[model samples]
Each structure stands twice: as C-alpha cells, then as structure tokens.
Target chain A: MIWKYICGSASSPLSVSFSERPRDGQVIFNSGVYLIGVKSGLLALSARCPHLGCQLAYNAADRRFQCPCHGSQFSLKGHRLKGPAKKEMTVLELRQDHECEGYKVIF
Target chain B: MQQTADYGQQTTDNNHGQRTTDNGPRTNYGQLALWAFHVALLTGVILSFHYRPWGDVFKSVSKISGWLPYGDFLRKLHYLAGQCFLILSFAHVLEHFLKETYRRIRPKEWSRLVLLFSLGFPLLFTGFILKGDKEGILAGEVMYHLAQEIPLIGSGLARMLLRPGEEFFLLPYLYHTVILPLTVIFLLDRHTRRLLPRGDWGWPFMAFLALLATFFPLPPDIPPYMEISHISGPWFFHGVQLLLRQVPPLWAGVIWPVIPLLLTALLPFAPPKLSKWGKRLTMAAWLIHGMILVAAWL
Candidate 1:
C-alpha cells in the first residue's frame, strides 16, 4: 500500500492543447516530456540524453538540444548530432485528442 | 624479506603505540578523516529520518531545509563532514605519498586505502544527487548513463546503483544511508586497524563542523528551467566533465578516471623504479586534472 502510494498509480497519457499549432523550432515541456514543434509535426521527446542520461535542455538560439553532462547535442528533430550520446533522443507516441483540441502524449 | 620487515615495523609504529608525537598533532590526518566519516555517518542517520526518497524529492528536501527545526543544521553538517572526510583522506594519502611511506604499507592494506578513497567519490556523488535539485537530478541521470557505458553489465550496474522509480531517489538513498556507510566503516576499520577514532581530533573537528554548519547552510536548489550549461558537477567531477566535452564517453567517462586510480593501485605492488614512475604519472595526472577543472570552471 505504501509503495503504491509513494510510486503513484500507473500514469495516464497527458493531453496538451494549443490555441494554434506550435511554431516551428518551438519546444514545450509537459508532464516530464518535451514536445518540439517541427515541420514534420510535434515531436514528443524524452528530456533524457541517449548517451549518458543527463537532462537535456533545448537551445532556442541554436535550435538544438544540449546535454550539460557530457556535452551531447541533438537536432531540433531529436537527431543525435555530437558528443557521447550514441542514439537519437527517445520519441514518445503522440495521438490526436478527440475531446481536447491538442494531442495525447503517451509517456 | 627486508621489505616485509620494514613494513611490519612501520605498521607497528603507525598503528600501535604513541599515536601522538612531540611535534605532530595528537591525531594524524588518517585518524581525523575517519573521525570525519563518523560524523558524516551520524549526521546522515539523523537526516535520513526526515528525508523522503519518493515523490517530489526536491520539495521534500526543501521542507527539511526550511521547515524542520535544526534539520538544516544536521543536513549541512552531514555535507560538510562528508567533504572533510574526503579532503582529509586526500591529505593523509598526500602525506604518505610525499614521505614515500605508502610503499612501506603491505600491498593488501595499501590497496584497501586506495579502494576506500575511490569509493568516496560515488558515496558523496550519490548524496549530492539525493538533494534533488536541478543539478542533482540531472547529475543522477548522468551517473545512470555513465554506468550503462560499462558494456555487458552496464545496464544492470546502472539499475543496481540507481533503480528507476520515483524521482530516481530510492536506490541512491539506499546506497547513501545504508550500504555505503557500512562499507566505508568496514574499510576504515581494516585500514586504521582501530575500532574507535582517537578522541583528540574527533571532538575538535565535530565542534568545527557544528560551527561551520550553524553559519553556513547549503545553497538553494535551482529549478530545471534555469540555464544549466554553466553549471558543473561536484568539485572532483569538474575535470572529467571538461574531458567529456573533448573525448568520447568511453574515454572520458571510463578510461580517463581509471588511469589515475590504476596508477595509485600499482604504487604498493611495483618495484622501486616502477613505483617511482607510477608516483610521477599519478602526480602528473592530478596536475592535468587540476588544469582541466580550472578550464571547466572558466
């Protein structure tokens, strides 16, 4: 009972609504996940670095995600560019929300 | 045979009678460091009573810092003492290194000291992460990934060190509060060959830590959204962080840190000429590490 309370219940998908489509190169953080607005569509990415799991920060000026830990860099589209990170950033599934105007991000 | 006799004499001289010298302090740095570790362990026990390893760890720590009476004092003391333990242990090793006495200690005993010193990093690092601030959380994740870089056992090692769960705090907390302290105490006992610390430095150091803790509290937690590119890891980690920027993860994260450690481990076992070279290489590594640390900070 205590473990369940502390760990919390299984998480539900998070829905985020936007007044309009997010601007290209824009990044939004919702429910511990980051969503990047790209030409392809909204790319829901984990803030975790694929190299060594450092928290990644999206650099707006460079339009790249930078990891402070090992200096790994990823593109705006979650592609690994440089440093120790071997794989592309983990992308979460995004589904259109019928009831809500935005998308449901499955974490 | 002669070396063995010399080692026996040195061990007896160092460990047995006359802990104090006419010129030297009542306690040596090795003893002082063990005392500091004791203080850190005691204060850590107190802090653990209030610290929650699940849910919003940052918020839990914030409450302990702000709301709990004397909680901040205990927390700061734990932090300060842990740092002192590492610093003083380094001083003890430096003293031995400079006097060329490290080679006189039995190879097994000397290796124990090496292992003890090496263990201090992860122990302190885990404690640093338990604070659950932006830096701490990120650092914890970095540690997890670094562990994963270990090849076959990487993922398992990572899980053992820091099991993924609520805020990734449970395994770190377990290691910090329980496993690490026990292991440190056991190693310290074998290295010091003493069940209790010499009271001389212990009491004074505790008083110093208490005063320090009273006046100086830990810095406030920075939110994750704040610019973190400028933020670095713990002090000892600065050099590695700088190296990571220039090299691949396997080299910077694994091989680089291991070089100095490997050299230090070789000190007691090597022949005279080889030992001298080992010492030189270790010192050079430290000097380079210092430069890298400065570069990272800059």
Candidate 2:
C-alpha cells in the first residue's frame, strides 16, 4: 500500500509540515537537506546528529547518517551506534507517497 | 546550602569503606586556598566602605580625606583583597582538577560549583565597572554590548543599562558596586555551604574582611576608559572571553552554547576508547586550559 498526503495550501515540496512523537521518530521540516531514517512500517526520525546539534545527512554509501561534530553515527532506523549520548536517536513520523507529483505535506 | 544537605542526613559513621587518615597534606592545600580567600574578602569590604563609585573627587582620593575613620586602610584593603579573591578562586579550580574532586562529588554538587562560578564572576564585573575609573568605563562598555548579545530581551535591557548619561560615564553606579554585588554575595554564601557541609569557612573569610582596611591602592589603571579597547570583566571571565576572541563573534557567541551538547554526545562514542587514554586526555585538557589561562594573564 502507498501513502499519499493531500495538503490544502499552495506550498513548496519541502514546506509541508511533518512531525512525530519521540516514540515514533520526529520529522523536522527545514530549508536544508536532512537525511531522515524512515521505516515505512514503523517510524521516521530527523537525520540530524543530536551531538553538537549538526544537521544530519544520509551517507548512502555507508547507509547511516553521520554527525559532523565529533562524528557520532546513527542507523537508518534511528538506533544510536555509540555513547556520549545516554539515549538513542529520536523517532518521528513519515508516510510514503505512492505517487504524488510534488512533496506537499498534508495534515 | 546547609538546609539542602542536612535534611538528607549526613552519616560520617559509615565505616564500611571510609578513608579517615588525617595525612594533613591533602587538607592543607584546601586550607591554603581558604586563607587567601579570607584575606581578599577582607580587603574588598574595607575598601568598599571609603570608595565612592563615581564623583568629582575620583581625580584624587581627596574628598575622602580625614573623613570616615580608617578610610585609608579600607581603601587599600579593598584593592588587595580583590587581587587575593581572584587568585584563590582560580587556584581552587586548578587544585580540584588535579585531585579530581569532580569525580567523587554528586552531579548536583558539580552543578552547584558551575553555578557559583557563573555568579561569582558577575559580581566581580559589577565591582570593577562601578569604580568609574578608566578600567571601570572600559569594562562598562564591554558589558553594555555583551548584554545586547542576549536573545529576545537584550535590546531594551542593554540600551537603558546604567552609565552617567553624560556620555563620559554611566550613572547611578550603585547598581554595580552595592546592589548587584550584595546580591551575588548573598547567593554565594548559600551556595558555598552546600558544597562543604561540615566545613566552616568563617575565620578565613573574616581575614579578608581585615585585609580590606589597608590603603589608597588602585589597580594598574592601564588602557583608557569608555573606549572598550580591551575587555576586562574580571580575570577569570577574561580568560574565557579571550579564548572566544580568537574566533568570530558568530562562532563564539552563537555556536558556543551548541558546542557543549554536541561534545557531550560525540565524546563518549568518540573513536578513542574509554580507557586509560581517555582519562589521560581529560587530564591533558586540564593542563592545557591552565596554560591558556596563564598565557592570557601574561
């Protein structure tokens, strides 16, 4: 099954709002590119490295989001690879658009 | 501080694993620092009694003539005490780092130590700028701009912040010298008690009171006032500020708050294993920080 969101207002693809609770990964909308780790069946978490608070990017080659500051790594599903942070990566929400032309976020 | 601790119940009799050997040397270092602090406090108080924050007589300690009893000694003591206070506070930090006092204390205690440091420096800032001399004026300028750097509420606060409106200096100097400093002292006493529950710091503290009785001593008086040419809030603060000065304003002011959070998370999982090497690194950092402090002072 494919997920589709139909938002009302006219907005750019990146402008759509996507947010999820900590339990489910949180989707943070931003101007910069973020490597979000999404499990279609389960969760979505913003791709930023919580350490040093750097915006995280997906390293497709490595299949993980790497933090620029101090280099902490997180798995695609938001599981933390190491310490320094007592907790795991935050989870957010996401839905797969089976076939939406543009990434317009809907409520 | 006492109230916060005693309520939890202190049990010195826990003999299961206690080290009560009075080797005396370990305690002596702490005691020496305490002695210095007492002397400084003494000087600061007496000098404050004769000192006028701002007035025409500032050109010379003249109007303060044959006036209030022991005025001269009070003034001298103030300057000397300030120097002593600065030295002890710094030495205390270094000694703690060496002995790893930070390791055994409860996190709550470390947090209190941080808070005391943050508050203590501000008191020193107030004391300096209120003097209204060259250093005071220069210090005030730095403070005014720094306040502006605060987020949402900074603009209004910084603009109206005290200075003599005459453009040459700020007015109502009482805010820095008397009002703010007193508030800091009150808070600091409560804080100190919490860290050293059974320890009594009074006698040594009183010695600082005595030192405040000595001379018409003024600081080096280097650099012009109101120019903001050099930034000297208090020596302890100056070191931090100087380190930041090496970087751009955006980096120092904006990026700094974020750095700690990132470092905390990234450091543990850092490539370096949490072994003897990690401990060594932390110690190295301590030494490096001290060296930097000395470098800045020089």
Scored by TM-score, the top model is: 1
lDDT of 2 by residue, B1-298 (tens): 0222121234333221332222111333333333544444555565556655544424424334346566555555554555555555455544554444444444344344444344445555666665555555545655564456567876677666654234333343555455555554554465344323244554665464564444335554433312222334456545445554454333543445334323322233334345345446655654555676688688
* DockQ for each numbered candidate: 0.53, 0.01
Per-residue lDDT tens digits for candidate 1, residues B188-271, read 777755647764556878888899999995866786556566556788888888887777777787778878877776788788
- The sequence of per-residue lDDT tens digits that candidate 1 reaches over residues A9-90 is 3362222333445677788764456777788887778788877677787787888889877788999778999887778998
Docking class of 1: medium
- Candidate 2 segments whose C-alpha is farther than 4 A from its true place: A1-107, B1-25, B28-72, B151-153, B156-217, B222-246, B250-289
Docking class for model 2 is incorrect
Whole-model lDDT, model 1: 0.74
Ten-residue segment with the worst summed lDDT in candidate 2 chain A?
A1-10
